[model samples]
Target chain A: AQSVTQLDSQVPVFEEAPVELRCNYSSSVSVYLFWYVQYPNQGLQLLLKYLSGSTLVKGINGFEAEFNKSQTSFHLRKPSVHISDTAEYFCAVSRLDSSYKLIFGSGTRLLVRP
Target chain B: EPEVTQTPSHQVTQMGQEVILRCVPISNHLYFYWYRQILGQKVEFLVSFYNNEISEKSEIFDDQFSVERPDGSNFTLKIRSTKLEDSAMYFCGGRQSSYEQYFGPGTRLTVT
Candidate 1:
């Protein structure tokens, strides 16, 4: 089984400021990591993922995440945020050798204020 | 680019009523899934489907819940008797070989 923890329930940042949303996971086996963003009343959009190779993964919308094996963490970061970036961010994980069902974190609400 | 689509953007039903939410996954995708999120809550996986049958399901997929690929283009989730707790935004997704899943806009079910 895989479990994810997103520490902050809400993050308020001024527009153009850098932001980081913390995420941690616990899994006995190897796993795939992902971050998704959901706008109000909309579906989740893939932000980034850590499947293999480089631990640092870049995604759409100028977002990125680093998969730290020792820390069991995958934190999402952006140098500058836009007001449109306000959304609910979810961190998810799936066991590599087991079922592909994704276990998601409680989510972090990003409020990019102008 | 192709993407997943869901119908009946919003549904209102009385308690104990049966409701079916529909979805059309991306073409060429083999895996389908259903997930739900109540207001202000995290998304929870309900079930996953492959090869015309269920591949995996969460504990929340109780006897009241079922999934089907009635046709090549349509995937549906049926709730036999909706409870107040069943009210949530139900999302349908599909994966084409990769681990990444594409999601639909979702159906907001309101059980009154």
Candidate 2:
């Protein structure tokens, strides 16, 4: 079994400011990590993922996440933000063996102010 | 770029009524899945399908839910009876071989 925790429920940031959304997970087996963004009334869009070989993974829209095994964390970061970046972000994980179903976090709402 | 498409973007049905949500996944993809997000809740996995049969399902996917690949291009999720609690945004997803799954715009089902 696996579970994800997104520490922040809402974040208010000004444009061009750096932002980070924290995520942590617990799993019995090796896992794959992903970040997905959801605009209002839409499905999730893959921002980036960490499968293997890299601790720092870059995703779409100038976003990135660093996977920390010791801490069980994958926190998303963006150096600059645009008004268009305002959306709900989700952190998800799948078991390395099954790799079929995804367990998701509660999500962090990013409100980018112009 | 190829992407998944779903029909009847918004559906409204009465309690105990049946509803079928339709999806057309990426042509070459072999794995399909259904997920739902209730208002402020986290996205929850309902079921996963491969080779015309269900590979896995979560506790949320109950006996009232069924999935079928009726044809080469169409994959459908049928709810035998919908409850008011079933109102949520339902997303259809597809994947070829990579673990990364692509999602469609989603269908909003409102059960009254």
Candidate 3:
């Protein structure tokens, strides 16, 4: 079984300011990590994922995340944010198997103020 | 690019009534899943279907909840009797392989 924890329930930042959203997970085995974004009245959109090869993963909208294995963390970051970046972000994990069922964290609401 | 599509963007139903949420997955995808998010809550997986059968399901997928792939392209989630707690946004997803899953816009189901 896999579980994800997103410590911050909400994060507020000014436009053009850098931001980071923390996420951690617990699993007995290797797992796949993913980040998803949900805009107001919209569906979940895949932001990025970490399967293997790289510790730092870059995603759409100038966002990126780094997978820290020793710390069991996969934190999302952006050099600068825009008001349009205001949305809910989720961290999810799936065990390294064929099931592909994802366990998600309680999302972090990003409020990018203009 | 092909994407997963869901029908009836919003649905209102009386308590104890039945409702069916529909989804059309991306072509050539073999796996499908259903998840729900209550207001201000995390998205929770309900079930996963593959090879025309349920491959995995969570405890939340009770007897009242059932899923079927009626046609080759359509996937449906049927609630035998809805309750106030069942009100939430339901999302459908399809995966082509083992990687990223494409999600539909979702159907907001409101139980009165």
Candidate 4:
């Protein structure tokens, strides 16, 4: 079985500051990686996805994540954050053979201060 | 850009009662799914539907859980004898392929 681990439960940052949310996965087989964000009381919105090809995957809202196979990590990063960026982020993984289902991380709450 | 949509954005029901959550997946999508997230927890997959049947389900989905695509467009999840623990946000998602999935706003089920 595959699983995702988000190292940080909460990350607090100031406006216009850089932020990185760490994510690691354990999967015996090859997998697809994704990052999703959820605003208060809203559904999840996709940030980025790493299916194959380039290790560096850029997403909406100026966010990006790198898929490192050797380290089994896909950490999400943003050069700068705004107060509107305060939301909960999740890291998810699905096996390449069967990508229909997803295993999600515990989630990291990004709190952006003004 | 068509997106998945769900009905009854919030529902309140008594324990031991039955609840059905409804979803309308994007048109022409081949795969459908149901997932739930408890307060302050990760989103957990419950079941996946394809060709009018279930493809995969988690241990969390037991006898109490049932999914059906009653018509051409609607996908519904029925929970029999709901418990307080069943209170959570249920999300509906659809995908044309294995790469990307579009998720609905979700239905907040509250069992008291």
User: How far in Å is the alpha carbon of B84 misplaced in model 3?
Assistant: 1.3
- The residue pairs that clash in candidate 4, if any, are none
lDDT values for all models: 0.94, 0.94, 0.95, 0.93
Clashing pairs in 3: none
TM-scores for all candidates: the values are 0.98, 0.98, 0.98, 0.98
Which pairs, if any, clash in model 2?
none
Error of 2 at A64 (Å): 0.7
Q: What is the lDDT of residue A88 in candidate 2?
A: 98
Per-residue accuracy of model 4 over B1-112 as CA lDDT, tens digit each = 8888999999999999999999999898899989999988899999989998899999999999999999889999999999999999999988886577779999999999
Question: lDDT tens digits, residues B1-112, model 3?
Answer: 8888998999999999999999999989999999999998999999999999999999999999999998899999999999999999999998978678879999999999
TM-score of chain A of each: 0.98, 0.97, 0.98, 0.97
Sliding window of 10 residues with minimal summed lDDT for model 2 chain A: A94-103
Query: Lowest lDDT 10-mer window, candidate 1 chain A?
Result: A94-103
Clashing pairs in 1: none
Off by over 4 Å in 3: none
Q: Tens-digit lDDT track for model 2 on B15-108?
A: 9999999999999999999999998899999999998899999898999999999888999999999999999999999998999999999999
Better by DockQ, candidate 2 or 1: 1
Model 2: what is its DockQ? 0.79
Residue-level lDDT of model 3, residues A1-114, one tens digit each, is: 788999999999999999999999999999999999999999999999999998999999999999999999999999999999999999999887647888999999999998
Quick one: ranking by lDDT, best first? Answer: 3, 2, 1, 4
Q: Fnat for model 1? A: 0.77
